[model samples]
Target: MTIPTPPPGPEPLRETIARHGLDARKALGQHFLLDPGITARIAGLAGDLAGQNVVEVGPGPGGLTRALLDSEAGRVVAVEVDTRAVAIITELASRAGGRLEVIEADAMRLDLTTLCPAPRQVIANLPYNVGTPLLVGWLRQAAAWTRLTLMFQQEVAERICAAPGSAHYGRLGVLAQWTCRCGVLMHIPPGAFSPPPKVHSAVVGLIPHAHQPDAALFRAMEQVTAAAFGQRRKMLRGALKPLGGESLLAEAGIDGSRRAETLDIAEFDRLARLHMRRAAA
Candidate 1:
């Protein structure tokens, strides 16, 4: 089959989708982004892609795929689980003049660090079903990348970039902010995709932290946040009953009477540090 060349004009996106008869698959949580302008905007947020490796997930109809290749990126490795989409991506990859590599596999099951080389960046309009887990996985293995620019439902984006004590703040916010510098670069309305998703979306960028103040303290930080936010409405003492409860707070210099949602990220880190010290001794 002759692979169609990358769209040469502004309307290439819609034309490609129509020509290919590519329909978004609900089973894959697929939402085809058909706006070249939006794709360009997203790629711009990724900063300098020159000679850098980028991994894209769920490249439905290759909207963002074209943009990444158009950028100066050395290579773009697109991972798509859907068999049909994978076939379509194969065509897109061929037309990309060897800059795009389409992988047919489940992104969650893959170890990205091993898949792509150094100077890596992840830029994707992630599938809604798997977006959070993917973000958490990448954030946990943060040493693998220099930066990540991804799209998610607006609510999830807010949670990822939310400040301490904000209503959107929770385990995701704490973990993401602790390991990386996160910011929301753009807000995408529901209408941006071919089949508009019910919720609005946003692009977020995360630059991983190189020097962690308390690297060993993350275990306790995870335990503390899980307990605290697990019962956010309760007083810290009551909510954290499993992990030394009030005693843990007293030792960490945090007030036991405060609710979990009210505590900031600094306080969480302090508690983690205290827990680490106790464990060591």
Candidate 2:
């Protein structure tokens, strides 16, 4: 017997998850977004999603998935790790008139740059556990995306857009700002999630800058930031010891006494460049 289709809109989110006996599993960081209004607004932040390819990570119960499809996005390629949600995503895809594609693959393992169509925007309420790592991967391949509208824990969101001298400014801030123009799009409370997360969440928008340095420079920044922030309490002179400490700071034209959180993206770029010089020498 052919089963009848459910009515459209946000109700399907709750119904689908309930019908499938799916609960938000903590291990997967699965806090499903049941509010379609909020999801719609998040999709809206992508700016004229119509005729644009969108990559959605972790489409639990197809809530945001439906929002993206309804926004008239040209196509949506949802990469989901949870096999349980596949059926729900497939249902959404079927309704999308061949515009939606669901890949039962881990977002972290999949390089979206090689996977999705060009002129793509990534919009998702990212699984909290893997959000930061996934974002780092994307930023490393920033050229592939037109924009990234992603959700992360409020703290992480702040860190991504934090300026130098701010308490949240550190490795993530430096790395994110190094390659993209980052901002907090909207703040979501813990209550917004089905099983409320311990902390608030925020949606962030990252548009790649015109002048991202080469891979080598990125690596250099990674190395330098890792070392500096690894021992953040210590001054640059002490923290960057393996890379010549005070001398390295001098070579970069930075003060050896400065701390990691005080350095902006430009300073980090300079430090990365200097680190590369040291490696070459």
Instruction: Give the best candidate by lDDT.
Output: 2
The residue pairs that clash in candidate 2, if any, are none
TM-score of 1: 0.91
Residues 1-281, candidate 2: write the lDDT tens digits.
33446556435577778776678999999998889899899999988876789999999998888888888788899988888788778877877889989899988888787666788989999999999999988888887889999999999999999988998888998999889999999999999989998999999999999877778878888899999999989999999998889888897899998899888788888889988977988
Q: Judged by lDDT against the true structure, how good is candidate 1?
A: 0.85
List, residue by residue over 159-196, the lDDT tens digit for candidate 1: 99998678899998998898899999999998988799
Model 2 per-residue lDDT at 47: 89
Candidate 1 segments whose C-alpha is farther than 4 A from its true place: 1-11, 212-217, 276-281
Question: How well does candidate 1 score on lDDT at residue 194?
Answer: 74
